[model samples]
Target chain A: MKKLKLTIAVTGLNNTDNPGPGIPVIRGIRESQEIESRIIGLAYENLEPGIYMPLMIDKTYMIPYPSSGTDAYMERIEEINQKDPIDLIIPNLDAELYTFMKAEPRLRELGIKTFLPTMEQFEERHKANLVAYGKKYDIKVPKSSTITSHNDIRKIKNDFDYPVLVKGKFYDAYIAYNEDQVTNHYNKISAKWGLPIIIQEFVKGTEVNVVALGDGLGNTIAAVPMRKLFITDKGKAWSGITLNDEEMIRITNDLIAETKWRGGMELEMIKTNKNDYYMIEINPRIPAWVYLAVGAGQNIPEALVKLAMGEHVAPYHDYQVGKMFIRYSMDMLGDIQEFEQLSIFGEIEQSQLHYPNTQKI
Target chain B: MKLKKNIAVSENGFLFDPNSGESYSLNKTGQLIVKLISEGKSEAEIIENIMEKYDVESNALQRYLDDFIMMLQQMNLLQKEED
Candidate 1:
């Protein structure tokens, strides 16, 4: 088969202490033997390591933060489209997805394609609504509450035991051993990520995450489950090993078919000591650990791109289990001039800069 | 004051502490500090070297170095003073 040539754009390139999925997603895309792709990086911050890896990203443009509103966001993308006429965009950030999903219609009209969950599918699966979502889907989920006020913190003692999880609407989670810890986390998380903090029952179990892709028509194209071997203080997976769990695959397929979900999603689950799996949280897009899935013999990002381009894709049946992904950060050296170019002009082409190959150290 | 004896560091900043069975990656600056510490350089000497090369102030370098050493201790990468 002749390799299909494509120009693809991706976001969520922040590979800092709290890494994003862009580099891993790009790695997955690049690993596709059937597809030859020119990658464009959409970065929100100037210092995102993906912007400096000229070998991986042919071009990079700084997009406005999601808080800039969808209009400004769309305008920047529109200008980029005029220059490059993007074939498809895979937005990897949780915060920027609302804008991209809302702009789907206009984007399609402009000949830009994206595979994403419907707004309804996206919202219903939010952490704030996870309890109802699990109920509707007939999945076991930990009891949780979404409270906007500190007064509600006291009421948690009535239903939940000590050591509940205090979580922000979008990010950050802390285990509070008592009411004071709950209140502390509530204040800290709410201040950083905004109101309506989520208080969830702490499920005692091993944490497992599944990275899956859906065809948007009740079909799961790919699913890979992994267990974190080592975790950083920030709760990021520093090292993880893939698992060959039939139950995990079954749950993923069931959830995808039930939701008729589209695009990439990460299911954060807890497998209790008794072996019952409880759904913890759902991230709407591909996770930062997506490269692990790719290495496990499922090129999910490639399949997702094909689905977005309206190509018929067969669901993957088997993958190598026990593949381990150990994430190790390395400094990507870049010239001050490159940072200046990206920050000042909001765009730069790799061909314009004569940079040496990006090394791991 | 010193990196653990079994710590193996690569040129590209990959650090493996055989004692903890954990691996870590550092930036260029972090790699330099770890390397210097392993070579028996004092905190003050490390600060002076970084300040001379990185165009940073002495106070800021000292503070960041202090924090870095604290993290190294937390990760069990630093050796005990008696060891």
Candidate 2:
């Protein structure tokens, strides 16, 4: 069979200690037998490791941060698309997804397709709105409330007990043992991620996660549940294995069917001792551990591209149950010239030597 | 009565359950009991073998074996009787 050839642009290239999904997602796309992709990496910072990782990115272009607003963000994407003609764009960062979702129509005008949740689907699943989302969707979730000021911290005890979770709008979650600790966390997280910090009841249980993709028509293209075997101090999974949890899969399917979520998402849930699964957070993009799903047999990145192209994608029925992924970091030597090119010009292209003769795009 | 067909038990007492992708480390006694179970030994036969090898009373060994088997079952390492 002739593979579908595509020029794909992807963001979230920050593969660090707290990694992004870009590199892993790219790896999945590269491994697809049915898709031939020329991967163009979109990076916010020059030091994003995916930009310099040998053959992973055919070209790297530094783009404005999403905080610069949709106009500036789309301007850079427009420039990149004009040069390379991106067939599909997979924005992989939580911070950048809203910008891309807002630009979906503009991107469509330029013939660049993206599979992302609608504005309503994206807004409903936010960390600050998770409790309401769970209630509306008929899923169990820990009791949580949003607080915008320091005054709300003292009032938390009236609702929730001590040792609650203080979470930021986008990232950073700290377990606050008392009101004073909540105040400290509130000040810290608000300074970084801004106002409306979420305070959630701390449920004691095993943390399990599922990386899934949903078609706009309510079909689950792929779903893989995993348990973290080892976690970093920042609460990122360093090593994880796929699981055989029917409950996790069912919940993922139900949520996708109800919301008709249109892109890649990660479901962070806590499995209690009583076997009740509580929805803790919903990340509206592919997760850093997504390559594990690909290894387990559901190449979600590839499927996502197919969906974005408006092609028919069959749902994945099973994955190898025991597949595991252990992340490791190694230093790679790079010339000053390469760094200077990307830093000064904001774009760098790999030479043809990086690609195999048969695989060069 | 039996370990999962795809379960792997290494000589160093490392046990791997392929069905759930969970692994466990066992002590000498734990490894011996699992090995005997894999060899299709019955509960009484397992206890008799352990009593002869270790300085343990029959009743005490029986109780320990029962507990160990239960743990294995809970971990999903042992195959169901129907299977």
Candidate 3:
């Protein structure tokens, strides 16, 4: 029953047209009534807006990009740990997760802990692997194929119709109405995000998502289903409201039980006109829309931290339905000097920035 | 040749078009290019300016600029060429 104090590190701080989950995750941590904490932001770029949000991030250090390999990234983390011993870290980016998962052992040796999916659990849920994953678990997933060449895009017509979804490995998805559009998206996404690109059967229905956390032992700690009220042209949920969908929750629990999934996950599912749910994609971390779950009553980040600390956490049974999260963008005023400091020195202290908490944001 | 009419640009690189009610966030380089484009700088003029300011090679910058302008066209933020 005692209040716990902890220091947490979080990545994926790029909250932009396309967002990373860090800011909302940090907000969830700050809202925790049971845990008092200081935030240490792990950023890949100096310009990640969270690096400038002083109240949300007490201090920040730049880490090498995942493409730089986990060795360099872990070395940067070690350097950060030497300055401030991190109690736990929540890796929020899909691109960077494999590195973090591979480094989990070394981090634990340095007294840093994390709650993440096992490498097996992580790999099986990948876009390329999801069809087999769904079949093994008896869940209905849209028919999909992973293609490494442009020729594969042409062949997709044999299995899928026009308007199939073409997706990148780490990001970007486009609904290609014809083969030419598919080729366009294929070239664009492959150039930026690399292969193998995913071409999924278009499941017609309302798109919905579930943000849930699992306890590694097949128990779901928290689950919240949401429907987007407004979708950006980029296909991000600009405004979304929570739903108390029992079937969505059941699918979430079933997937967690079957995979023994650990840590935070978002299930991007499409409910068909016939009311069938076709799992589309499984993101292995808390979604950018996670603040919705925190606001809806379950503080997933807080509970995830506790689970990482090897503490007992009970499954959340109920949350208020119809909670809405409407996202907005605000300019964060930063001085040239602050940018200079972060860019030149690769580190910045909160005290030096003189930035306002502006919780109003 | 210019940013769409009534487009609002911010120093932080957030772009809003009052015409379409669409919002976009651009990186630092994107902001610079868009600003140059809106200032009536020709493509070559923008490239020459950026080459002097940034370390990127002219050829690579040219390729990137072309890609970015294509993106602008795709977003319908560019005015239609007067036929």
Candidate 4:
């Protein structure tokens, strides 16, 4: 008899071997003899199997516009399905969330399972929607306003502080100056994204990501919030440390519970001087540091699969603390023109000593 | 290098990852799987147990569970338990 293989349809996987922010960790999972799975990168192409082959996938989905535009990259999922049906489709990235949401009914019909949120639920948690969710959840998100038109940007320049955050339709967020600057930037963004403008307060402080798994029934499986030390201009988590912030965990869980969520999530939050966590963007997908969670003894991927299998997962207490994760490369250019565009901190070249990457961590 | 595991056995999902200071919360099925791994259950036996409970397909479960555990070992959470 042929052994059964549980297939995971991975969306947003680009064909490459470079250690990217996502996917490699999934590969690591396969390499460790922990899980059995195949991958679909961007609708076409499969990485040939090798040491990395167990973790490498050659399939993808192209839905869910980024702060930019929807890439239609997910159209390939259908092609891969024609060969062998996927058991579960993990919308492993923010870009694929909308794609998964749209494909939810079809996926269910095909017997593929996924913990997908509704479009409204997804939109409601978006950064621009943060102000509204904050109002409802009582979480302190920065002061933000929606931009339905170019004139909205003009109104914002006079109203709010400069060096403000300009959010895209997807997850990529950047900062801009006064109205003209915002308009120019928005024009470029809208041209590429076809998304409405999201002008928000530029928050300052140590940024952190609270990675958690939630039951659709309002219970939490695990939560690991991290404080970031470095970032790309695009606002990806570059270097960070995992800390046990009861306050942060409580507030983030409170918000998730209120929303009645059922899936894995990663949220970007800024711990201000007042020690308040001002809510920023929320990514509904699992984070790139999912391997970090696995390292910490909380394997969300394993937990998530069990839940999907309808097995009762035991809820374990979080007793670990003060673990740090650092990503290092000689390319740490402290002085770059692009750094200021995405950074809240000014010119100060921090040491390579303080940084750590789990690969090098 | 090949992967090894030294997971503790009990009803509670108490995983103390000595490599990373992060503790874990595991569900019942997760507990059983970890126990099986600690007891040195082969991949085939684990799959048989999984099939007994889950109404879902096995091939997919095997792939996911295989990759999932491998990830644990790569992260150093799974190591050979010294008898």
Candidate 5:
């Protein structure tokens, strides 16, 4: 069998305690038998550990944050593409998806392909619009209201109970037992992620998550449900196990069919003792724990690349049940020159370190 | 009273339910009851096996066995009649 050789660029390389999806996604792509992948790591910070990992990234380039606006972001991408000619780019961060989606057309013109949700799909799943989205799609969701100011925090008591969830637009969620706690979390989260903060009805249940990929024409390419076995202080899954939940899969498939959702998505849901599943949040991109889906059976990043290139890919039907993933941290030693190179030159080729004869990018 | 066909109870008292992908560590008595249940022992047989090995009275052992079976049912480690 002939392998497709493609150069793919991916973002969200920060593999810290609160990891990103980049390294694991890269691992999935590298393990593909159908494609021979050349990975280019796109990092927003100089210290993103994926840049320094040996034999993983072909080259690493520092990119401007999405908050710097589209022009700066695209210009940096264009410069990187000029050197490496990225066939496809996968933007993994939730905060960066909007910028990438907005620049999709320009990226297409630059001969780079991306499989991402359309602007309508993205907007409909925003944290602030989840209630309306649930109603529109006929999915059960916790009652939530978006508030822009501190004064609106007082009104929360009238709408929700004492133990409500105080959440930010992009990230950060706190279970506030009283109005004072709501005000405190609101200030902290708003100051970081900005308003309007969302006040959501807290539901008591076991949290379950599903990571799935969909073709724009309403086909589910892959879906894997998992229950977190252990959680970190940051609320990220420290360990998790794959589950056999037919209802969760049905909900995912129906939602994809109804929305014609494109690209990878993570559904955060709460399953109550009464066996009701309530939609909590929908992340618009592949999650950090995507490798668990790959480990179980479905290689989502590999399939996603195929879909982006307009290949006719079939949906995966089965994955190994009882598969578990436990995350751990390891420290690697690197010379100061490697850090200095990326910090000063904005790019570093890992191959250039070992194979001095290799051409520098 | 049958344990799920796929449920695995290791000798070290670790119980794994493949259907739910949930595992639990059982104490010695819990392990003994689950082992007997997996062997297709009836409720009365489980009580007899426990009373023979342990120093507890039959009535007290019966109550503990009932409670243990309920826990197993709640955890979905026991196979339903349909299965």
Candidate 6:
């Protein structure tokens, strides 16, 4: 084997952890030789010829820090294609995924391969349209509405209470208890971010997130169900446990089938007291916690990466079930301050961890 | 902050939102924040506690917290009443 030379266009080099959790799927695939990874973040420099660094595989790569818009963004992908053949262009962050999806046709014409759902299906899955999807699927999703003004949120607050949530169509979600709090949050977020916003009903229930890797043809190849064993201040799943969630598993299959969905997709669902899992929102791009799925067993990142490189991967395989993950760094203090955070997940009967292993921690 | 909430967060740091009835994975910093938040620590309070104890900058930590805290508010994890 010539060691399949595959190039991954990632968000950025931003971490010190050898194979940080952000893109663990890629790490899992390159397990033997550590495939080549080129990261482009909010601060990549254009001067350096993004060759593989010494820390990374020998293949050289560029780190184009600030990817501006369609033109410059497309240029980076195009440049790679012009040089050595680029294998896969995986958009990890929300902004990049949205932009890449919008400019998909152009990128394809230029001979760059990528994996993502169509723009129509993509729009249907965002937080802004979650309610509409609930209605479409006849599943009890949250009462979702767009917030163009303070008055829009007031309508929900007056009827509801302080436990209202404001969600970004992209990669952000905020839980505000009062009308004033939401207004302040909306102003701060709207003026500086990428897209519009959506406000959701505060349903009291259990939160479950399901991730599935689908072939571009609407066929789901693999699925992973996890419970948040730990979380960040912003409600990010800090640590989690993989489990055999039948209902969640069914909801996922049912969702993509209804949408005739394709490409890789992730769903955020909240099951209420009645045990009804109300579909919350969707992230079309790769979720940051993908490492857990890889660590558990199924290496979707490698599969997706291989697929992008036009490789014929094997049929889907079930990953390591019941695995748990914990992120490091300063923010981890939030996990400590908030002990009840991981108390929600009652399903995980077993777990798995990286590095120092769970025995010591 | 009591451990009475439905969300099952593990010791090694796994958070399950039994409220939403869904499970998720987190990193170490994320584990700490969720643990603290679940323990009922306020945002400023969490920030103050974390800053004094860690090597990360305050602004960066706050920025990273921007999303999860908002999620806490949205999911009712932060509570509707102001402390």
lDDT of each prediction vs. the true structure? 0.88, 0.89, 0.88, 0.62, 0.90, 0.62
DockQ of 2: 0.46
Candidate maximizing lDDT: 5
Q: List the residue pairs that clash in candidate 1.
A: A361-B12
> What local lDDT score does residue A15 receive in model 3, on the 0 to 100 scale?
90
Query: Local error of candidate 3 at A302, Å?
Result: 0.6
Lowest summed lDDT window (length 10), candidate 2 chain A: A352-361
Better of 1 and 5 by DockQ: 5
The reply for model 1, stretches above 4 Å from the true place, is: A353-361, B1-83
Ranking according to DockQ, highest score first: 5, 2, 6, 4, 1, 3
- Quote model 2's TM-score for chain B: 0.96
Name the candidate, 2 or 6, with the larger DockQ value.
2
Residues A1-361, model 4: lDDT tens digits? 2322577655434323222324634544454444566654432222211112222543333323433433333344554566657788766656557767877777787788887655766888876678888888788889988787876776666768888888776644667766677887788888876677788888887677788778777777778877665666656555556665678778767866788777878887887655578888877767776666666667777677666656576754573555556654433222333234213321112121122332311
Docking class of 4: incorrect
Model 4: DockQ vs. true structure: 0.04
lDDT of 6 by residue, A166-256 (tens): 7765645788877777887788778766447777788887677877777666556667887777776667777787865668877777776
Per-candidate DockQ vs. reference? 0.02, 0.46, 0.01, 0.04, 0.58, 0.06
| Candidate 5 residue-wise lDDT, B12-66, digit = tens | 9998875466899999998888888878899999888888898899998888888
Candidate 3 lDDT tens digits, A1-361? 6878999999989998888999999999888888989889998888898888757888888888999888888899999999999999999999888998999999999999999999999998899998999989998999999999988876767888778999998788999888889999999999999899999888898898999999999999999998887999989999987775789999999999988899999999898755689999899999999999888889999899999998899999888676788888898787899988888988888876855655422
Measured with C-alpha atoms, the lDDT of residue A143 in candidate 6 is 75
Lowest lDDT block of 10, candidate 4 chain A = A345-354
* Model 3 misplaced stretches (Cα beyond 4 Å): A356-361, B1-83
The CAPRI-style docking tier of model 2 reads acceptable
The lDDT, on a scale of 0 to 1, for candidate 3 is 0.88
Candidate 4: true interface contacts recovered? 0.06
Tens digits of per-residue lDDT, candidate 2, A254-348, equal 99999999899999999886669999999999999999999899999999998888888999989988799999998766677778888899998
Scored against the true structure, residue A109 in model 4 reaches a CA lDDT of: 78
Query: Residue A1 in model 1: shift from native, Å?
Result: 1.5
> Which sequence of candidate numbers ranks them by TM-score, best first?
5, 2, 1, 3, 6, 4
Q: Residue A314 in model 4: shift from native, Å?
A: 2.2
